[model samples]
Target: MDTFVWRDDYSVGYTPIDEQHQELFKRINAFGNALWEGQGKELLAAHLRFLADYVVSHFQTEEGLMTTHKFPLYEVHKPVHDAFVQEVSSVLNRIADAGLDTATAILVFEKSCDWTRAHVRGMDQELGRFLGAQRNSTAA
Candidate 1:
Protein backbone atom coordinates (compact mmCIF):
# COMPACT_ATOMS: atom_id res chain seq x y z
CA MET A 1 0.00 0.00 0.00
CA ASP A 2 1.24 3.46 -0.86
CA THR A 3 1.24 5.78 2.12
CA PHE A 4 -0.60 9.05 1.99
CA VAL A 5 1.81 11.96 1.77
CA TRP A 6 1.06 15.39 3.19
CA ARG A 7 1.40 17.99 0.53
CA ASP A 8 2.08 21.66 1.25
CA ASP A 9 -1.19 22.64 -0.42
CA TYR A 10 -3.17 20.76 2.19
CA SER A 11 -2.21 23.15 4.99
CA VAL A 12 -5.04 24.95 6.78
CA GLY A 13 -2.99 28.13 7.39
CA TYR A 14 -2.83 27.55 11.15
CA THR A 15 0.21 26.27 12.92
CA PRO A 16 -1.47 23.92 15.36
CA ILE A 17 -3.92 22.45 12.90
CA ASP A 18 -1.25 22.14 10.25
CA GLU A 19 1.01 20.33 12.66
CA GLN A 20 -1.73 17.95 13.65
CA HIS A 21 -2.57 17.33 10.02
CA GLN A 22 1.03 16.42 9.37
CA GLU A 23 1.00 14.09 12.33
CA LEU A 24 -2.12 12.42 10.98
CA PHE A 25 -0.42 11.87 7.66
CA LYS A 26 2.49 10.32 9.47
CA ARG A 27 0.25 8.03 11.49
CA ILE A 28 -1.68 6.92 8.46
CA ASN A 29 1.55 6.29 6.64
CA ALA A 30 2.77 4.20 9.53
CA PHE A 31 -0.46 2.26 9.46
CA GLY A 32 0.01 1.61 5.77
CA ASN A 33 3.59 0.53 6.28
CA ALA A 34 2.48 -1.92 8.93
CA LEU A 35 -0.17 -3.30 6.63
CA TRP A 36 2.33 -3.72 3.81
CA GLU A 37 4.85 -5.40 6.04
CA GLY A 38 2.28 -7.87 7.35
CA GLN A 39 2.94 -6.83 10.92
CA GLY A 40 1.13 -8.43 13.84
CA LYS A 41 -2.42 -7.50 14.72
CA GLU A 42 -1.19 -5.71 17.84
CA LEU A 43 0.87 -3.30 15.76
CA LEU A 44 -2.09 -2.58 13.52
CA ALA A 45 -4.27 -2.10 16.59
CA ALA A 46 -1.83 0.47 17.94
CA HIS A 47 -2.11 2.54 14.78
CA LEU A 48 -5.88 2.30 14.89
CA ARG A 49 -5.85 3.40 18.50
CA PHE A 50 -3.74 6.38 17.58
CA LEU A 51 -6.20 7.25 14.84
CA ALA A 52 -9.10 7.00 17.27
CA ASP A 53 -7.35 9.19 19.82
CA TYR A 54 -6.28 11.74 17.23
CA VAL A 55 -9.80 12.13 15.90
CA VAL A 56 -10.98 13.17 19.33
CA SER A 57 -8.07 15.43 20.20
CA HIS A 58 -7.79 17.03 16.80
CA PHE A 59 -11.51 17.68 16.57
CA GLN A 60 -11.48 19.36 19.94
CA THR A 61 -8.65 21.61 18.88
CA GLU A 62 -10.44 22.63 15.68
CA GLU A 63 -13.82 23.06 17.35
CA GLY A 64 -12.30 25.08 20.17
CA LEU A 65 -10.75 27.39 17.64
CA MET A 66 -14.09 27.82 15.96
CA THR A 67 -15.78 28.52 19.28
CA THR A 68 -13.15 30.99 20.49
CA HIS A 69 -13.09 32.89 17.24
CA LYS A 70 -16.89 33.05 17.18
CA PHE A 71 -16.93 31.51 13.78
CA PRO A 72 -20.47 31.90 12.45
CA LEU A 73 -20.49 28.41 10.98
CA TYR A 74 -19.73 26.66 14.22
CA GLU A 75 -23.03 24.83 14.42
CA VAL A 76 -22.86 23.61 10.85
CA HIS A 77 -19.18 22.82 11.12
CA LYS A 78 -19.56 20.67 14.21
CA PRO A 79 -21.93 18.19 12.66
CA VAL A 80 -19.34 17.52 9.99
CA HIS A 81 -16.87 16.76 12.72
CA ASP A 82 -19.42 14.61 14.48
CA ALA A 83 -20.15 12.64 11.35
CA PHE A 84 -16.46 12.01 10.79
CA VAL A 85 -16.02 10.88 14.37
CA GLN A 86 -18.89 8.51 13.89
CA GLU A 87 -17.34 7.10 10.76
CA VAL A 88 -13.97 6.56 12.39
CA SER A 89 -15.59 5.13 15.46
CA SER A 90 -17.52 2.73 13.30
CA VAL A 91 -14.31 1.50 11.70
CA LEU A 92 -12.73 1.12 15.10
CA ASN A 93 -15.68 -0.87 16.23
CA ARG A 94 -15.48 -3.05 13.16
CA ILE A 95 -11.88 -3.79 13.96
CA ALA A 96 -12.90 -4.82 17.45
CA ASP A 97 -15.62 -7.08 16.12
CA ALA A 98 -13.82 -8.58 13.12
CA GLY A 99 -10.14 -8.31 13.96
CA LEU A 100 -7.51 -6.53 11.85
CA ASP A 101 -8.06 -8.46 8.66
CA THR A 102 -7.13 -7.13 5.26
CA ALA A 103 -10.58 -5.85 4.35
CA THR A 104 -10.99 -4.09 7.66
CA ALA A 105 -7.59 -2.45 7.44
CA ILE A 106 -8.24 -1.35 3.90
CA LEU A 107 -11.57 0.11 4.87
CA VAL A 108 -9.99 2.13 7.66
CA PHE A 109 -7.18 3.39 5.45
CA GLU A 110 -9.41 4.36 2.55
CA LYS A 111 -11.95 6.11 4.72
CA SER A 112 -9.27 8.07 6.57
CA CYS A 113 -7.59 9.19 3.39
CA ASP A 114 -10.83 10.18 1.73
CA TRP A 115 -12.19 12.13 4.70
CA THR A 116 -8.92 13.94 5.36
CA ARG A 117 -8.67 15.19 1.79
CA ALA A 118 -12.28 16.28 1.45
CA HIS A 119 -12.57 17.93 4.87
CA VAL A 120 -9.29 19.80 4.62
CA ARG A 121 -9.96 21.02 1.10
CA GLY A 122 -13.56 21.98 1.74
CA MET A 123 -14.48 22.93 5.32
CA ASP A 124 -11.00 23.56 6.74
CA GLN A 125 -9.92 25.80 3.90
CA GLU A 126 -12.97 27.93 4.51
CA LEU A 127 -12.11 28.18 8.18
CA GLY A 128 -8.58 29.11 7.32
CA ARG A 129 -9.78 31.88 5.03
CA PHE A 130 -12.09 33.20 7.70
CA LEU A 131 -9.29 33.15 10.25
CA GLY A 132 -6.93 34.91 7.87
CA ALA A 133 -9.53 37.58 7.21
CA GLN A 134 -10.14 38.00 10.91
CA ARG A 135 -6.45 38.46 11.55
CA ASN A 136 -6.13 40.98 8.77
CA SER A 137 -9.06 43.04 10.00
CA THR A 138 -7.81 42.99 13.55
CA ALA A 139 -4.38 44.08 12.38
CA ALA A 140 -5.82 46.92 10.35
Candidate 2:
Protein backbone atom coordinates (compact mmCIF):
# COMPACT_ATOMS: atom_id res chain seq x y z
CA MET A 1 0.00 0.00 0.00
CA ASP A 2 1.19 3.51 -0.82
CA THR A 3 1.59 6.13 1.88
CA PHE A 4 -1.34 8.43 2.52
CA VAL A 5 -0.50 12.01 1.70
CA TRP A 6 -2.26 15.00 3.13
CA ARG A 7 -3.48 17.50 0.58
CA ASP A 8 -4.58 21.09 1.08
CA ASP A 9 -7.78 20.29 -0.74
CA TYR A 10 -8.88 18.32 2.30
CA SER A 11 -9.03 21.39 4.50
CA VAL A 12 -12.46 22.27 5.83
CA GLY A 13 -11.48 25.84 6.81
CA TYR A 14 -12.07 25.20 10.52
CA THR A 15 -8.72 25.74 12.15
CA PRO A 16 -9.01 23.49 15.18
CA ILE A 17 -10.70 20.57 13.48
CA ASP A 18 -8.53 20.91 10.39
CA GLU A 19 -5.41 20.87 12.53
CA GLN A 20 -6.62 17.77 14.33
CA HIS A 21 -7.34 16.06 11.02
CA GLN A 22 -3.88 16.92 9.75
CA GLU A 23 -2.34 15.45 12.87
CA LEU A 24 -4.41 12.33 12.32
CA PHE A 25 -3.10 12.02 8.78
CA LYS A 26 0.44 12.49 9.97
CA ARG A 27 0.14 9.81 12.65
CA ILE A 28 -1.56 7.38 10.30
CA ASN A 29 1.04 7.97 7.61
CA ALA A 30 3.82 7.51 10.13
CA PHE A 31 2.26 4.25 11.25
CA GLY A 32 2.00 3.11 7.65
CA ASN A 33 5.63 4.03 6.95
CA ALA A 34 6.79 2.22 10.04
CA LEU A 35 4.83 -0.85 9.03
CA TRP A 36 6.25 -0.73 5.50
CA GLU A 37 9.77 -0.33 6.80
CA GLY A 38 9.54 -3.70 8.52
CA GLN A 39 9.54 -2.27 11.96
CA GLY A 40 9.47 -4.69 14.87
CA LYS A 41 6.13 -5.93 16.04
CA GLU A 42 6.45 -4.05 19.31
CA LEU A 43 7.05 -0.76 17.53
CA LEU A 44 4.25 -1.25 15.06
CA ALA A 45 1.93 -2.21 17.87
CA ALA A 46 2.80 0.97 19.69
CA HIS A 47 1.99 3.03 16.64
CA LEU A 48 -1.31 1.27 16.16
CA ARG A 49 -2.14 1.84 19.81
CA PHE A 50 -1.53 5.54 19.39
CA LEU A 51 -3.53 5.65 16.19
CA ALA A 52 -6.49 3.97 17.81
CA ASP A 53 -6.47 6.32 20.77
CA TYR A 54 -6.11 9.40 18.63
CA VAL A 55 -8.88 8.38 16.29
CA VAL A 56 -11.36 7.96 19.11
CA SER A 57 -10.41 11.24 20.71
CA HIS A 58 -10.49 13.14 17.43
CA PHE A 59 -13.87 11.77 16.46
CA GLN A 60 -15.27 12.65 19.86
CA THR A 61 -14.06 16.19 19.56
CA GLU A 62 -15.71 16.58 16.20
CA GLU A 63 -18.88 15.00 17.43
CA GLY A 64 -19.01 17.25 20.45
CA LEU A 65 -18.73 20.31 18.28
CA MET A 66 -21.50 19.08 16.05
CA THR A 67 -23.73 18.43 19.01
CA THR A 68 -23.05 21.82 20.49
CA HIS A 69 -23.94 23.53 17.27
CA LYS A 70 -26.95 21.31 16.74
CA PHE A 71 -25.73 20.67 13.24
CA PRO A 72 -28.57 19.30 11.18
CA LEU A 73 -26.63 16.36 9.97
CA TYR A 74 -25.24 15.40 13.36
CA GLU A 75 -27.45 12.35 13.64
CA VAL A 76 -26.39 11.09 10.25
CA HIS A 77 -22.74 12.01 10.75
CA LYS A 78 -22.39 10.34 14.15
CA PRO A 79 -23.09 6.81 12.95
CA VAL A 80 -20.13 7.08 10.63
CA HIS A 81 -17.86 7.87 13.51
CA ASP A 82 -19.26 5.01 15.54
CA ALA A 83 -18.84 2.61 12.69
CA PHE A 84 -15.24 3.69 12.09
CA VAL A 85 -14.33 3.13 15.72
CA GLN A 86 -15.88 -0.32 15.63
CA GLU A 87 -13.98 -1.19 12.45
CA VAL A 88 -10.67 0.03 13.82
CA SER A 89 -11.23 -1.88 17.04
CA SER A 90 -11.94 -5.03 15.11
CA VAL A 91 -8.71 -4.66 13.17
CA LEU A 92 -6.79 -4.01 16.35
CA ASN A 93 -8.30 -7.10 17.92
CA ARG A 94 -7.34 -9.19 14.93
CA ILE A 95 -3.81 -7.92 15.02
CA ALA A 96 -3.62 -8.74 18.68
CA ASP A 97 -4.94 -12.24 18.16
CA ALA A 98 -3.26 -13.18 14.88
CA GLY A 99 -0.09 -11.19 15.37
CA LEU A 100 0.83 -8.27 13.19
CA ASP A 101 1.97 -9.10 9.70
CA THR A 102 3.17 -6.25 7.52
CA ALA A 103 1.09 -7.18 4.52
CA THR A 104 -2.17 -7.59 6.37
CA ALA A 105 -1.73 -4.59 8.63
CA ILE A 106 -0.68 -2.38 5.77
CA LEU A 107 -3.72 -3.29 3.73
CA VAL A 108 -6.04 -2.43 6.64
CA PHE A 109 -4.16 0.81 7.30
CA GLU A 110 -4.51 1.88 3.68
CA LYS A 111 -8.22 1.23 3.79
CA SER A 112 -8.44 3.46 6.88
CA CYS A 113 -6.53 6.17 5.09
CA ASP A 114 -8.93 6.03 2.20
CA TRP A 115 -11.86 6.15 4.60
CA THR A 116 -10.46 9.23 6.29
CA ARG A 117 -10.05 11.09 3.03
CA ALA A 118 -13.51 10.19 1.86
CA HIS A 119 -15.11 11.00 5.19
CA VAL A 120 -13.42 14.35 5.42
CA ARG A 121 -14.47 15.22 1.92
CA GLY A 122 -18.01 14.00 2.25
CA MET A 123 -19.22 14.51 5.84
CA ASP A 124 -16.63 16.74 7.45
CA GLN A 125 -16.61 19.33 4.68
CA GLU A 126 -20.34 19.69 4.94
CA LEU A 127 -20.18 20.03 8.73
CA GLY A 128 -17.48 22.61 8.45
CA ARG A 129 -19.53 24.64 6.05
CA PHE A 130 -22.48 24.48 8.39
CA LEU A 131 -20.41 25.59 11.36
CA GLY A 132 -18.77 28.37 9.44
CA ALA A 133 -22.05 29.70 8.22
CA GLN A 134 -23.40 29.62 11.75
CA ARG A 135 -20.43 31.57 12.99
CA ASN A 136 -20.89 34.17 10.30
CA SER A 137 -24.55 34.54 11.06
CA THR A 138 -23.85 35.03 14.75
CA ALA A 139 -21.15 37.58 14.01
CA ALA A 140 -23.43 39.53 11.74
Model number with the top lDDT: 2
lDDT of 2 at 82: 97
Candidate 1's residue-wise lDDT over 89-135, tens digit each? 87677667555876678777887898889888889888888888888
Model 2 CA deviation exceeding 4 Å by range: none
The per-model lDDT (C-alpha) reads: 0.83, 0.87
The residue-level lDDT of candidate 1 at 138 comes to 98
The TM-score measured for candidate 1 stands at 0.91
TM-score of each: 0.91, 0.93
Q: What value does the lDDT take at residue 113 in candidate 1?
A: 90
**Best of the candidates, TM-score:** 2
What's the lDDT of the predicted structure labeled candidate 1? 0.83
